[model samples]
Every structure is written in C-alpha cells, then in structure tokens.
Target: MGSEGAAADRLLSWDRVSLVIGLLLLIVGHYQGLFVAPAEAMMGDVGRILYVHVPTAWACMLVYTACFVFAGLALWSGKGKWDAAMEASAEVGVLYNALLLIQGSLWARPTWGVFWTWDPRLTTSAIVLVLFVGVLVLRRVITEPERRLNLGSIAAVLAYAGVPIVYFSVKWWRTLHQPFSSPATVSDSFITPLRLAAFGMIFLGIGLIGLRWRALRREVERELSAPALPAALPTLELGQRGPGGAA
Candidate 1:
C-alpha cells in the first residue's frame, strides 16, 4: 500500500506538471498567433482563430482515438482501469469536440457569411460529437459496473467508426470547408505557432485524461472492495403468523 500510494502520487504529480506546461505553451502560442504572426493573406486577422481551432481539432481526434484503443482493451481484458481510461478519454474528447464546433462556427460566420452550414466536414464532425455523447449517455443509464463497462466500451468503439469519416469527408467530397492543412499548404509564418498550439493541446489533453482516469479507477476500486448487502428476509402477510406461531 505504501509503494502503491507513492506511485499514485508520482503519477498525479506528472499529470499536474504536464498540465502546467501545456497551459504555458498555449498562452505563448496564442500570444504569438494573435500579435507576432502575420495576418493571413486571404482572411486577414480573423484567420488567427485557426491557431487554436486547428489544434483543438487535432487533439479531439487523438483523444477519441485513445478512447477507441482503451475501449478495445477494456473489452478484451475485462479490466476496470481500461474502462476508466476509455471513459476519461471520451469525456475529454467530447469537450474538445464541442470547442472545435464552436470555434469552427466562429470562423465560419466571418468567412462564409453564416454561422453554420451542412458542409460535409461540419456535418461529419457534428455526427462524431453526437455519437460520443451517446456513449456517455449510455454509460450513465446503466448501473451494473461490468455491464456498463461492456456496453460503454462497445458504444465507444462504434462511435469511433465515424471519426475517420469526419477526417476524410473534406477530401472525399467537394465541400466549402478547406482540405487538411500541412506544412506545405500553410504559410511558413503560421507554422510555428500552429505547431506550438497543437502540441500544447495534445499535452493538456493527456494530462486531463490521466487525472480523470485516476479518479475513475479509484472509484471502481472502491465499488469493487465494498461489502455486499445481506439478502432481505422474507416478509409475512398481515393475517399470517410467523414461522413458529400457532395457527
């Protein structure tokens, strides 16, 4: 127990350190993006949103991918920790997905003259959000831990099937949304801050998921360790006597 506690402490310390570093990087990157980086040739200053937006999209995809992997592990191993990890990643992914949609809408309004549209990228992204949200909802509705883990893992796996579609939608179909950005495609001036913010988001997501996973694992352990309630005694009818009573 002593060694286990020490290890847990070390893990939590690492998570905190990662979160702090991620936050610092994000602040620096966003500052550079907003002030130091050159305005885009086409969208002008508004294009700065991509610094955070693009990073968020990347982080969301990676987090969901982690959830998928964890879900598979939970299903195969029947382990509580794996299930906890899956839940944690799913939660973080949902948050990132929500931010992605909001940022996309903000970017869209000025560039496309509307807050939203049924563009293939946007549609698939929204579907991804809905599917993961359903996974969370399914987990909440189920009470039995083993059953919940099995079903939630299954749901997460199914939800992840849409992620690839979301990623490839812009390429597979002609849409208003732009294709995937790369170093070759984006300007040299924009790459530094974009990369910084992307790495920042990834680190932050890892920290958040790790912390959440620890909490969930502890909860599962407690549930498993707790003593089960004794079975209820049989009840007697109003007019009936006790087992030893005379009629």
Candidate 2:
C-alpha cells in the first residue's frame, strides 16, 4: 500500500510538471501572437484568434483519439487504468470541444457575419461533442462498476466514429470553414506561435487527463477492492415463528 501510494504521488507530480510547462508555453505563444505577429491583410487583428482556436481544435481531436484508444484497451484488458483513462480523456475532450465551439463562434461572428451555420465542419464537430457527452451520461446512469466500464467503453468507441468525420468534413464537402493549415499555405510569421500554442494545448491536455485519471483510478480500485455485502437475512412470514419460538 505504501509503495502504491508513492507511485501515485510520483505520477501526480509528473502531471503537475506537464501542466506548468504547458501554461508557460501558452503564455509565450499568446504574447507573440498578440503583439509580434503582423495583422492579416483581410481579417486584420481578428485572425489572431486562430492562435488559440486552432490549437484547441487540434487538442480536442487528439484527446478524443486517445479516448478511443483507451476504450479499446479497457475492453481488451479489463484494466482499471485503461478504464479510468478513457473516462478522463472523454471528459477533457468534452471540455475542449466546448471551447472549440465557443472560439469558432467568436471568430465566425466577425468573419462570417453570423455566430453559426450548418457548415459540415461545424456540424460534425457538434455531433462529436454530443456523442461523448452521451458516453459520460451513460456512465453516470449505470451503478455497477464493471458494467459501467464495459458499456461506457463501448459508447466511447462509437463516439469516436464522429471524430474522423469532423476532421475530414471540410475536405469532403464545400464549406465556409477553411482547410487544414500548413507551412505551404500559412505565412512564415504565423507558424511559430501556432506551433507553440498547439504543443502547449497538447501538453496541457495530457496533464489534465493524467490528473483526472488518477482520481478515477483510485475510485475504480476502491470499488473493485470493496468486500461484497453479506446476503440479506431471509424474511420470516407473518405466521412463521422465529428459530427459537414454540411451534
């Protein structure tokens, strides 16, 4: 028990370290984007939103991808860690997904002249969010730990089907959303901050998932280790006498 606790503490320390590094990187990246990077000829300063927005989008997809992998591992190995990881990643994915939508809307209102539209990318992204949220809801409604893990894993796997569609939607269909940005397409000045922010989001997400995973792993361990309750004593009929009563 002592060794296990120490190991857990060590893991938590690593998570904290990742979080601090990520925060520092994000601070630097956002500062460069806001002050150093030149404004776009068309969108002007508003394009700066992409610094955070693009990074969030990347991290959100990556987290969901991790959730899918964890779900598969949980199903195959029936391990507590994988189950905990799946839940953690799903929760973080949902958070990032929410942020992605809000950021997109903020950028959209100015660029597209509306807060939202049924563009393929936006539609698929929203669906992905709802699907994972359903996974969380299902986990809550089920009480049995093993059963919850099994069903939730299955739900997470199904939810992941939407992630690829979200990624490819812009390419597959006509839409207001732009295609994936790259060195060839984007200006040299924008790449540095974009890469910094993207990596920052990735590390930050890892830290968040790790912290949540630790808490969930402890819960899983406790549930699995708990002794089963003794069977209820058989109830006596109204006319039945107690064991020592006269017949």
Candidate 3:
C-alpha cells in the first residue's frame, strides 16, 4: 500500500511541469499556426490544416518511436518496464492517429476535393492504424499475463517495422497526400510553425506518455511483486493489456 502510493506520487512528480507547459504551448502553437500564419497562395484558408494535421501526424510517429525504444529495453533487460513504456506509448499513438484521420479529412476535402482517397500514403496509414488496433485487440483476447507479455513482446517489436515504408512510400508508390513537409522538403515560410508544432507535439507526447509509462511500470511491478490486494482495491490499469491480468 505504501509503495503503491509512493509510485503514484512519483509518477507526476517527474516532468509534471514539462507536461503541463508543453501542452499549453501546443495549444498556443495551434492557435498561432492557424490564425497567424500566412495563407497558402495555392490552398488559401484550408491550408491552415497543416498546423494541427502535421503535428498530430508527427506525434503519432514520435510516440511509436518511443515504443520502439521501450521494446529495445524490454528485449535487452528481459524486464517488463519496457513493455509498460510500449503499451503506454501505443495508447497515445492511437489518440494521435485518430487525430490525424480527422484533421486529414478536414484538410483533404478542400485540398484534394475529396475526404477519402486510394492514395498510397492514405491507404497505408489506414493499414497502420488497423495494425495497431489489431495489436491492442490481440492483447485483450488473451488472459494470462505471462502469455500476454510474450505475445506483446512480439507485437511491440514488429509494430514499428512499417515506419520507414510510411516515410518513403510517397517516392516508391507516388501519391497525392503530399510528401513529408520536412525542413528539406518545404521552404522556411511553411517550415517554421510546422516545425514548432511538430516539436511541441513531440515533447507533449513524450511527457504525456512517459508519465503513463511510469505508472505502468509501477502497476506491472505491483502486479508481479506485490501481494494480491482485496477486491475493493482498484487495480492500476495504466492501459488495457489483456483480460485477467497478463501482459
């Protein structure tokens, strides 16, 4: 009991201000990007979608990178701490991916004249989303923690394999979704706020998911090491792993 309390207390203590300030900066970046930036001579008002769309998409990729790092830790140490990081990162990845879908749709309608398309980048991203969802669902279907962890280990290692392909698919497949508007790909006029938004979202995601990851570590440690508490005590469900306490 005392240890659990200590863990919970320590979770937010680490990066508590960075998390709060980062989120506030992101909100500010969103406002500044949409309202303050100059309109695209080509896309006009709708081009403002880059403000939110780019950051959300960037956050998705950044969070997944965090997952890969955690997976490395887990694979190296054979400890569950890495698994916790991967799980928490994946949860936030889902949220950011969903944000990308919505923002992309809104931007696509004006830019592409359609909300949905068979463009390769668009198509593959949807596939990536499905892949992650499948991973999450697979975790839920299993019951035992040990078995779930084994399966999750496999999934975590495999999930980021699609990233490079996501990055270069535009060149390989040729699509209308526009290549990554990185500093090299775009002019400084467009690059400035987009970069800021991306960095903001990245820091924001790290701080956010990092906190969740710590909680997950504590929870998993408790589950494996702490005594089974009474039924009335709530479990530290940092994020869903699988049914019946495994993973």
Candidate 1: tens digits of C-alpha lDDT, residues 1-247: 5686588778457778888888988998999999999998889999999999989988888999999999999999988889999999999999998999999899999999999867666667788999999999999999888899899999999879767766576546645657677767988889989999998999899999988987898886555454787877665555554355423
lDDT of each: 0.86, 0.86, 0.72
| Better candidate number, 1 or 2, judged by TM-score | 2
Error of 2 at 90 (Å): 0.4
For residues 1-247, write the lDDT of model 2, one tens digit per residue: 7787797787458778888888888999999989999997789999999899989988998999999999999999887789999999999999999999999889889998999866666667788889999999999999898898899999999878766766576546655556666657899899889889988999999999988998898888677565888877765556665454423
TM-score of 3: 0.79
TM-score of each: 0.86, 0.86, 0.79
Question: Which number leads on TM-score?
Answer: 2
- Model with the higher lDDT, candidate 2 or 3: 2
Give candidate 2's whole-model lDDT.
Answer: 0.86
